[model samples]
Target: MTINCLDLFAGSGGFTLGLKEAGIKTKAAIEIDRFAVETFRHNFPKVDMHHRDITSFNDKEIKSNFTGVDLIVGGPPCQGFSVAGPSQYGKLDDRNNLVLEYLRFVKVISPNMVIMENVKNFINGKLPSKDKVIDVVTNILDKLGYDIKIEVLYAPKFGVPQSRTRVFVIAIKRGCGLPFPEIHETHGPDKKNYITVGEAITDLPFISSSAGYDDSPDKLTYNEIELSTYQKMMRKDGKGIYNHISMKHTPRLIERFKHIPLGGSLLDVPLEHGQRARNGTDLDTKARFKMNNQRLDPSKISHCVTASFQSTFVHPVMNRNLTAREGARLQSFPDKFIFKGPRTLMSKSLLIRENREHEIGLSQYNQIGNSVPPLLAKAIGSAIVKSFKHKVNDTRRATHEFA
Candidate 1:
């Protein structure tokens, strides 16, 4: 039996890939950004795609492409609730409204199962108004007649090389008797079990942070052997070396990078110009890192790779921010899964985000950073499939009784 799925708010098919890994076929996907939509089409050439505001996406048209969608899965952008982000839209930003849009489709499609993902803070987080986001979500999903199970899944616990934590809400139709996915602990709580940043990207070619974008989607091997089990898994069934381009940084930035040691911080680097200060000179006048941590420890799992990692995270060894390719490896995306869109913009400032009216469009870096780690997704998918097997057995026994 084929399990059909629709990826709502599908940003370059991250959740879709997870479903595919779980033996599900993605029937269609909807994304708002022009760049994300283009990348999704490039990767999943045969899959149907809709590009535009999903609120305006008509169900009548969707019905023509697919019938009886078994699952609808997506992670509505949660920047407003993201602990790493501003965290208080105080009022619904256009992005936050996508949560309602997600529920809208769930009500329409009424899939046997629905999976929604968001930042870890989403559970207790509030929208800009009186109603809590969680309360609104649970109430609406309950009204739609689905039983819900919510969990805050940590990425590394399920084989991702990073320590990203996100909330997943799984809704199985009433009386389905399906439990939430069985959690797996692949790597955690021990030095040997954890995947380090070096282990994840060691097999890829070393590129300078100050390099320009490369258009070719050809694989470039690092001339080194794939040593880690994690590396082997990502490289498995992969043929292309795509989206490895580095940000084109300036001479001063390059000089700053050189000064930082392995796992050193951009914040700690001495500045070229500013009001002189004792700690590396003119620290206050310089660009603030605003990083959760100033440096990445090469020997350990990485900090979350946000869209702004270009300026925020220092390479464990290289004198640059992690390349898009390196970040993908850390995110457990196979080498074949190349990111498409502008590699790096002239500026990645916070201005556009502050303007509540505008959405922060995804860049290649953003696409990879914002994705669910494919390994973690695979684990979840595998568990879901396991539950479905039980569901199938239950149906068979019930049918036999009826007969």
Candidate 2:
């Protein structure tokens, strides 16, 4: 039997896209953002969609549409729980409260399984009372009669071009004994060599941060690397890339990009610029946050790419900010996914986001700052399918014995 999925907080349908690739069917999706909703609907024309706030939704409404979904999958808004934000796990973060809404849906639909993805920091610390994330998450699942298994997964380990680390929780019902996904491979056969920024974007065509073209639906090509495995897999249909949003950088930011090295950071730049060149907090000395740690090396992979531009997100080679296409590419978004809204939406988002210090009223850039890269989502989806298949086999055996 085909596994059915109900995707909540489905941003650009990244989780949905990966689940579909893993052979699960998305019966319905609930998303709150207008841009995300339009984009999800455009790509997934066949799936039913709910475009309203999840808080207002009721269990009876969901039951009316989906009776017994096999899986409930989503990455709820993480701004509240994210380290990038205030890092407040439980209090004052309204977004954090929404997780219970997800749990509520699970209580109503009682899906056979649940899959959730979030930032790695979620595992690094506790909620309140110093409780582990698993403790909190499992408590919710336990009430729903599901057994949860979790792992902090790195994307580069699973064939994604970028090095994105995220926490994934996979929960199966009590009777279903599903094993966790084993780490199959690491980047470059050694612990030292990780998926580099160069490997991820080297093949794409060069567009300066200052350039913009009228919206065109025709698929386009950038460079010789278009046929590479990553590109080919992303463009599964063999059509050219489409809807790759590119933004140019200002002249001043362009000058700053010239100072960053392939793996160097803002510290390498001059002290007069008022940029903090120090490493992260001097507490952990290793290069944990170095991936995109405020450098503009187009030759290197970006740190966690955000939808917001306030971070030191200039291009490594160009003087301008990273274009929307570059940001999307770093996030593992497929080229064909189109974003609606005016061009100024991109500009205003970056401007308002770059300066804001507080957690509230984040620009669109900050809103997308810590999204689960879609490429990583696909790998997690693969693992979920693997676990699900194993459970299906076990259930078959038990059924046969009873018969």
Candidate 3:
């Protein structure tokens, strides 16, 4: 009755951790990012990790390596399908095609259940082959004899502090008589009130932008601040905090943060310190984006934590941005989940220009930002586990009647 999983495109093992929490075992994981692989390895040392491009694996190699996997779970890279990206690229962005690679693995592994997660826009996004991405994926799953269910889940409803919405495609093999699993909301107006940003992270010790270390021997212990129920849960297994280092910011940027209020963004900053035009001139436009250097409101849930969140979000009370540890907390990563690799990486253009693209990998911030919130993943995993139990019970009843 144990459920075994194969994680494809597993970024920092978020999905795997959630499945583990739900009593499912992840037998193996595949990831292309080296830093992500490092973080995954550090946390899940026992899980087999294939640190290579998923596309490079031939069908024979996949079948030979991964057999008897009861479930397959992953979040194919979503930059191309994300609405946050350039609209002109649309389906043409090469990353969008990775979904096909994900499907290829599923075909080879022949798992009983498959769960794929992506940005909410992915549900309607089109593939480069002029087909709706969802349609193409579901069509293949149908032909492969699997019933599919698609839904856009709001993270906060599942106990994550951030308002992240993602599309989940759940496929169950035909004849299981198992419908899509129903994951009930644990946090909302009707249930418990959504966890606030403060509740998620206030227990951690505060550090300034100029303070803290990437990998110090010194582990920070809990301060005297009262811990919230969520914080208590995060620290349940953690002895001390690591990877809580803050990013160094320029004095000018620090000054700008002073003018911004909680829940404010770029629009809140004065023209003198506002976002500059490409040519370094001040633009008089009042355009504002919720993601631009957003100062979180401690009383409410946070805005979406994107991969570039190190620079996108300002700390609620501090003038500097959130540390990798703080971002992890908002994503519902427990305090014990230590992130590995550089605290922050150079921009892609800068790295490419410097010819160091291969030398450097995803930063800790990038790994945390790109991860699925563990709590939300746990909800999905629990639902699937429930379905498996139901199937077992039904089989038992049938066998008893026949006897």
User: What is the C-alpha lDDT profile of model 1 across 223-316, one tens digit per residue?
Assistant: 4774788788777876656787777667766676676666555555555532234575566625545452245676888887776666667676
TM-score of 3: 0.96
Which 10 residues in a row give candidate 1 its minimum summed lDDT?
A: 285-294
Q: What is the lDDT of residue 77 in candidate 2?
A: 73
Clashing residue pairs, backbone N/CA/C < 3 A, model 3: none
Output the TM-score of candidate 2. 0.80
> Candidates' TM-scores?
0.88, 0.80, 0.96
Q: Pick the candidate with the highest lDDT.
A: 3
Rank list by lDDT: 3, 1, 2
Per-residue alpha-carbon lDDT of model 2 for 73-151, expressed as tens digits? 8887766566766565344354666666788888888877788877776665454444555567779898778877887
Model 2 alpha-carbon miss at residue 292, Å: 9.1
Those runs of model 3 whose alpha carbons end farther than 4 Å from true positions after fitting are 88-91, 189-192, 217-219, 278-280, 287-290
Which one wins by lDDT: 1 or 3?
Answer: 3
| Model 1 segments more than 4 A misplaced | 58-66, 88-92, 189-191, 217-219, 271-281, 285-294, 346-360, 400-403
Instruction: State residue 70's C-alpha deviation in candidate 3, in Å.
Output: 0.5
Listed per candidate, the RMSD to the true structure in angstroms reads 3.7, 5.7, 1.7
User: lDDT score, residue 14, model 3?
Assistant: 91
